[model samples]
Target chain A: MFKELIGKRSAPSKNVIERGAVKKFAEAINDPAPIYIDEKAGKASRYGRNIAPPTFPITLEYGAIEELVLPTKGLIHGEQKFHYKRPLFVGEEVYGVTEIKNYYERTGSFGKMGFLVIERQGTDAQGELIFTEEQIIIINEAARKGMPV
Target chain B: MTAMTEIKVGESLEQMQMPPVTRLDLIKYAGASGDFNPIHTIDEEATNAGLPGIIAHGMWTMGNLAKLFTPYVEDGFIEDYAIRFRNMVFIDDVLTLQAVLYKEEENKREFKVAVVNQKGQEVVNGTVVFRMYEVGMAG
Candidate 1:
């Protein structure tokens, strides 16, 4: 089941880190944390710069949908984890790369599906590695009543 | 919109890492996700969840990982990325995440990456793919 699936890779993306985008993202998360909106408010917070809510730039960080697309049903939001070195602030130019690491076929309630994982790394304008994420997506196999080894 | 043209393989960029994982961070994540499963807030809830102590949300870690892609060429950024919630990172878990060039040029773009805890345990495992130009998009 894990054999048919192989590997792939991709290039990096860049951003100017528009502070406003970060604000919208914060609102999306409904974070009441002031650091994400007001500079003065941020000064009073741990991170001096207006911060960005985690996962705020994922979709934007990765240029296109195909980068992470693995067609499957019951596409559910599984689980997530976070490790912060420092809070992300608004208006900080950042860049990163996204690549497909691996994949395989597995059986589940929905039947046989392809399980794949993708990773992204965003570094500040100074070229310092900041955030890195690896997302897992499972794509269900298309119906083919009788076709297998 | 052409500015967000596309990103190719081998290109690289960066962003900032969160300050540090804290108990408060977990609580904030809990509020955002509405996953007040308790384990993220109370040690008792964590123990009941079969965890070491108060644990953070798996999604929080994933969200942190996603922030890594914010900086891409104009029409740049992560097309998509995902991971399996493998290990648990506690309050003191200082994390360092990175993705070096694993491989490219395949019909399928792929890269190898990982998130490590202070103890050097791999808390999460996964990959990311980028598309310079989406294969299918309507103007």
Candidate 2:
């Protein structure tokens, strides 16, 4: 069912790497690193400014591809990977887009499951590539059956 | 502080013992990450979805793994990270984070990292590649 959606890309979404959001994310994860929260410490650090956590991109909005839809519950985050050219600085603006890389199904202990692979990229205002995130989401039989018709 | 020179392949980084997972943690993470996935924060929703109860977001657990490297910010930053979710983490589960240096290069280091539940079963495992700053290099 998801085969037709392979290679589909979403419209670019704009995201501002806000300081407040960064701080909340950092705290939510229980990481109190000065570079992420303290402005003075950020200035003293090598980056010379507050930077978002490596996984902070999860908080950014990646516009949805109209044809791609999955259940809101029971989907499993099977795997994830991140590659970064540089950390995103607070107050910087970046554009993000997601593409459906592939999709397949397999029978496992949990019964038949669908694996959906998607990749998201973030670019700075100058159009420089900042980071890429690839993830595989597992749709168990129950979740697959619950998908909207 | 661990200097770049002192890091040795085959050595273990200091392990971090995180407090038990809590519902409040998931709630805060949902608000911060904008994931708002009901399975992660609502017990009834999770049960209906076939889960035992509410569970932590995999991203929430993955995000905390970065804490193991915060001490080395001056030496370098994580250039790459990859992981698989081996198991679901439930509220009240105590997680211990550990990493071992597996490869070392002139300007980079690689570590195999894992987060194990209190039972010592790995719930997540992966690798992190840290890119180092050159001697006297400015940020």
List the global CA lDDT of all models: 0.56, 0.90
TM-score of model number 1, chain B: 0.75
The parts of candidate 2 lying over 4 Å away from their true place are A147-149, B135-139
RMSD of candidates 1 onward, in order: 14.3, 2.4
DockQ for every model comes to 0.07, 0.67
Instruction: Report lDDT (Cα) of residue B77, candidate 1.
Output: 37
Encode model 1's per-residue lDDT on B1-139: one tens digit a residue: 1122233445432423345677878776665555666767888766754568876666667666554443332222344455666687788677766554445543234544567776778777677654443433443
Model 1: runs farther than 4 Å from truth?
A: A1-7, A63-69, A72-74, A143-149, B1-139
Q: For model 2, state the Cα shift of residue B133 in Å.
A: 1.6
Q: Compose the digit string of candidate 1's lDDT tens values, residues A12-97.
A: 67776666666654543334356567778767654456667656645355444343443222333344323334445577777766
TM-scores of the models, in the order given: 0.46, 0.95
Fnat of candidates, each listed: 0.11, 0.76
- B2-60, model 2: which lDDT tens digit per residue? 66548799988888899899999999999999999798999888887778999899999
